[model samples]
Target: MMRRFEDARILMYSHDTFGLGHLRRCRTIAHSLVEDYRGLNILIISGATIAGAFDYRARVDFVKIPSVIKLRNGEYTSLEKHIDLHETLKMRQSIIRHTAETFEPDIFIVDKEPMGLRGEVEETLAYLKTRGTTLVLGLREVMDAPHLLDAEWKRNDVMRKIGQYYDRIWVYGPPDFYDPLVGLDVPPAVRSKMDFVGFLQRSVSHDHGDDHRPSGDYILVTTGGGGDGAELIHDVIHAYQQDPTLTHRALMVLGPYMPAKQRRKLVRKGSKIPYIEVIEFDNRMEELIAGAKAVVAMGGYNTYCEILSFDKPALIVPRIVPRQEQLIRAQRAAELGLIDMLLPEESADPLRFAAALKALPSRNPPSVNAKGLRLEGLPNISRIVGDWIDGRGGKEPLRVIKR
Candidate 1:
């Protein structure tokens, strides 16, 4: 009974509390969905300060809510000092509910946060559930240290709420790669709703990399969103200062959120190093990563995907504070021989970091056996969505390359 289902609307929510990771991930999926289904329209409700900075497709649009920022100590506050956190949360909740009512999305997808930043989206989820709109929860391949996540959820009864509201739970990675809920006491029902869609792959539209890419092979160092990235950048610069023989030209991107003072110091110091180049921010990260000989990054989910998609050798310096999501991911990926990892303390050692950078360019890129690595999230999502819309109910995922 599959119909010709040509037209549909999908609404996505991204509570970008910290960096651009949530918003970027949503945008990537939104673009892919629209590209696959010509008649589909996607509306993303985002809390990113620079939500308007990136481009969107013809049918892809976004609604910007008041931005909220997360501090290193794991607390959230209004992005604007003048606005009270309580009032901002109220405004965000109201805006989300109103948008959901107006959009009437066939599918409602919430990224990461189960209850949406202090349970702001709880009411919307209930409303959508009553309306019979397909409610989906999208999660990163790695969440956080299990105990930390478990305690946080237990305090709010988030696991129970997820089961009650969501019809499906999409973990954006292959099941074998990692289980986001491994240590949690997830009920059988919630477990059954889980779908391991593999990693979301990245692609560059065109090769505009000539401008930034080095003539000879170089390492591209990037910290997604750059709020907690100053430490990594400082380490890299110090490594170069310590090792005069490290000749590989390094291109570093200071993400938009990095403090102005830190950025200036890094720029001034990096300028003295003939082989190092520092840029403020570039939306074309895929291009830079693709063109590089290797990558040095803080290993955010998006950066991890980019590393695999581009098949570049990478050195991941995963952060351990606030949340251990990056550390956990880096550890797993390193264990699987997908990437090399260094702890923050280890990476801070100028000599150790310099040696890693020197070896990075010549190291082998990611290569695995048939059951090794897969990037099938986008295609599978499109297929399942198409099936749902056409009344075909395609629950199974499409296969990836055998290599």
Candidate 2:
């Protein structure tokens, strides 16, 4: 039997360390939950560098964990403290377990990662399962391709783990376009627990407010985390330099983790351009994107959602290595006529990059058959979550209008 939303206490976990995507998505969902269930009390477990920047309702609270980052060599390390990786992970696990035990939430929502911060959630899930707490895994719309996903699943035993432990799997994207579980060989029983809740993105209000807009036509270049974005940034600068006639000014946001030396070099180089502005980081990305004519961004899920939500023409350069998830998302979005994708090989040529940017205006804006593709998923997702809590089966699939 489902519990009641207004009277329920929810525990949400988002282990965001490198970039703002996970943290932002989790916050959006939490906000939606609060809006739908007026009296909902949400406790967010996040490790984002910018957690304190968000303003939450009185019923919402957060536990900020130690931040961590993924190294180029595929290793995870702490961002703030210089502790050993193993020790840091262990400490994180302890905190997660302690939080779950103390709070005694009715439902537990784990975002992106199933094992939580370095497999921390595993301990919590075990404890919760024994204590009769509902466990749900919230996955982004797109994961990597079949081969990569298979390898990852096998290595992590994600399929088996989910089958045994989770009560529900909520995908934040439409299955009609891309079903994340398509080729995974999941059991029928496990599949029954899956729900495609559409894309969970923050809604854009008509009142964009008085955010500073660039004087002339300018391209916004951003990588959620500057760690893997240096190459993309370099290529954009090179592309602009190659063609002096590139009319648009460039605004590059070297994300928080971008090394000081690298940032200084980019700043110096951008100063020479006379048409470029560089900032270390800006929390108000939605406003910045709203004001831009076009966007050149790394193909992270959150950024893709933002571009679609704003109806802005975009040229996405998805990172290939480490995880092909971003590349897969870019390709899918391009296939759907939503955005343009420029692969790494194509981005190697300055002319190619220039051409992609120049052709942005021709691409069609994102559209849905229902409600005109206005990004209605946040509210609907919240409603469904509330219904489930209210002891409503929530068996019906949320309707989504495809373009």
Cα miss at 381, model 2 (Å)? 1.7
lDDT (C-alpha, whole model) for all candidates: 0.88, 0.76
Which 10 successive residues of model 1 have the least lDDT summed? Answer: 394-403
TM-score for each model: 0.95, 0.89
Candidate 1, residues 1-403, lDDT tens digits: the string is: 1223456889999999888999999999998887777788899999988899887887899999999999989999998999999999999999999999999988989999989999999999999888878888999989999999999999999999998989888899988888899899999989888888889999986434356444776799998999889999999999999999988999999899888999999999999999999998888788789899999999999999999999999999998999999999999988888888999999999999999999998777886422467798998788778867765333333433211
The predictions' CA RMSDs to the true structure, in order, are 3.0, 3.5
> Could you tally the backbone clashes for each prediction?
1, 1
Model 1 Cα displacement at 348 (Å)?
A: 1.1
Error of 2 at 387 (Å): 1.4
**Least well predicted 10-residue stretch by lDDT in candidate 2:** 394-403
